[model samples]
Target: MNRRTYLYAISFAIFAGRFVHGAEPSSIRVLVWDEQQREQRQAYGDQFLGEAIASHLASLPGIVVKTATLTSPDHGLSDATLDATDVVVWWFVERVVSRVQQGRLALVTLHSAHWSKPFVRLMQERAKSDALQQIPEAERATARIEYLNDQPYGKVPKADAPLAPALTRTATGWSLVLPGCIFPAYRPDGALGHLTTLLVDHPIAKDLPKQWDIPQTEMYNEPFHVPTPDAVVFEERWDKGEHFRSGCVWKVGKGTVFYFRPGHETYPVFKQREPLRVIENAARWLGGEVRKNAP
Candidate 1:
């Protein structure tokens, strides 16, 4: 495993040490908000906002994770799923949020969830053409090669459209657009709070040192323009706005919502460390003590 990967494994072992001693484990039911971006289905896609978390939690006994999305019945968060869901991680910008504020459904938002280019690519591509032929053999092969090489949307300085060619080249692998176009790594506003980052004991960041592949990894590094006080739970010293908001836990009638503002389609934290910890904790927190569900 890579350095970041090894760190998380170590951190998980460290964190688990506590659970092994004093904590009584409870089952966590997690739901990620995934929307099918029909077009970008090529470049990069899916709505499993908390996938990294889901994977980690799934390994823990008692935790049950199910996926729900915007494309599913009732946007994938059906009544049954919602009722059973201890935590729901949402990141779709276009998704119509039900702020009904039920005592259930802990909602964790990632990347502030204000962008959904994968969704945009579908509308734009489909609105323009469907008689589309398969990607040219040369470009298709190259894009696939790029993806396999782990170079999809390589390093970009700044952007309104950073992922264009860097991504267009591999977009096909993500099944986004044909080849040649790039995806924007971050929007204008996204560059705001990203000028610096501080790391600490925040649960979400507890494993970052071990999970993030800094020099070799690709993160949107969007700057948080309107950062709120204490809203930042952890920060990256090198990257300006890379902050981890410890954890957001809210109580519902008998359920809960843990809206996390991490994860971005840009870097795709689907297999990152910090995100995994956030998810594991959120699942358990939302899932609550076993007694909460007892007779």
Candidate 2:
């Protein structure tokens, strides 16, 4: 088998071992971890952003929700708590990467989390895997790989610069350029953004309108520097002609990583129906609840 197929087969084997033939968990355990910046008060008021999301999730049936902040004990992620969790809806957190890779839980990163450590690491891993997949099968076992450093944070790549997560064959093996996990440009002006569901039938797009708008949001222009996603569920555009792959999913090891890019602490974007629906759908799908309910 090709390297990519082999890796996926192994991931599936590990994932399949976790469940019985016809049994699935009755309730999905969701953990919402937020940095809880004071600036969120501008939009969420007394209830913090994380707490607001937790409250909304708690109102849904078959979902068990918990809120955690930077100040929470153990940062609200003690072993006991993680052991009980099935999905993490993260604003920013890094400790769960290993757990996600182990198929113990799944991760959903919100806007700006593209720079979070966990997301970066997972993207790097995916980049390495992609690089290895390009090697000939006979040389794969012995290929030597070197990962180059990431671009500086907030540094925009020149339009003519090489795209990252780039791979080059070497005399010995390969040199891989890790994803910078940032885009070429961003504007925090809270302008309106138009969104189109690129994968309407995707579980993460369930119940979402084919076309929607974020009344207020930061604009993230693309050529997003990351490994190509397994799926791009939503695309966002601005009147100025900038566009981005707003909702993307990647398979990392035995689990999943999803990034949704329509948020800013000072905007009430999450309060809208479509964004919340995206999060809810992602949680259900990531937590295995959607698959369990599938006919």
Candidate 3:
């Protein structure tokens, strides 16, 4: 592990130690939201993609799982629903961005959610964090950041667009920061990926092979434009020369945010055992729930 990875592990262990000793553990309430887009049928037959995931999570002990979709009235979210959820595993983004910002719940954003509103907002917040350190308190509120792609707010450039460069400040009274959201390009046709574990000791990496194959999955070329990750537990490479930091974790406000890149709507990526295990591990880790009972 690199210095950053080691530090992240130590910090997480310290945080988890508190809850490990003090009180009785509570069941984690998980909300799995799928867009239920028709394209997903190419991978999941009869079952909505999200429903398949919900089924797996429900089978696990100490988890209360609920599946929701875009078709639900109020889009499957409400004050009550949000109140009951402790961790949200989502394929698309819309209603939950505010709740994440409030630190009301943690987030586990799947594949395409890289472009989702909450993910974009998190990237922007990371940009602001980097930008603030370079300026005085006198200029923070008045400062305007120039996003590299020049896309309007809430808009991401096309997949073919160039990756934004490093964040810098301009002499013209502005901050020029790369949105750090998109990669340089993508290959949606699917590639065979070789995934390698980078942080073996992390709870998210538990029981996963040191290296594994994703027989076929979409490819995302990197340098992923987000801020430096708190921990990168996995890296994936394609035979076609594409690479991505496949599993990344970040501390967002009082809650945490995790991004896992594997699933593609047209593929049965999530149906694979390893990917499912990672999701199960992430949900428990983020929700502060136990993965195994203490003997």
TM-score per candidate: 0.44, 0.86, 0.79
Q: What is the lDDT of residue 144 in candidate 2?
A: 89
Candidate 3 lDDT over residue span 99-132, tens digit each: 4444555667777667655666666666566667
What is the full ranking by TM-score, best candidate first?
Answer: 2, 3, 1
Candidate achieving the largest TM-score: 2
Query: Superposing all C-alpha atoms, what RMSD in Å does each candidate have to the true structure?
Result: 17.0, 7.8, 8.5
lDDT scores of the candidates, listed in order:
0.35, 0.72, 0.65
lDDT of 1 by residue, 181-275 (tens): 12234332223222122434544444445333322223334332111223354433224434333233333223333334433334444454545
How high is the lDDT of residue 271 in model 1? 59
TM-score of 3: 0.79
Q: Give the TM-score (vs. native) of candidate 2.
A: 0.86
Error of 1 at 156 (Å): 22
lDDT comparing candidate 2 with the true structure? 0.72
Worst 10 residues of 2 by lDDT: 6-15
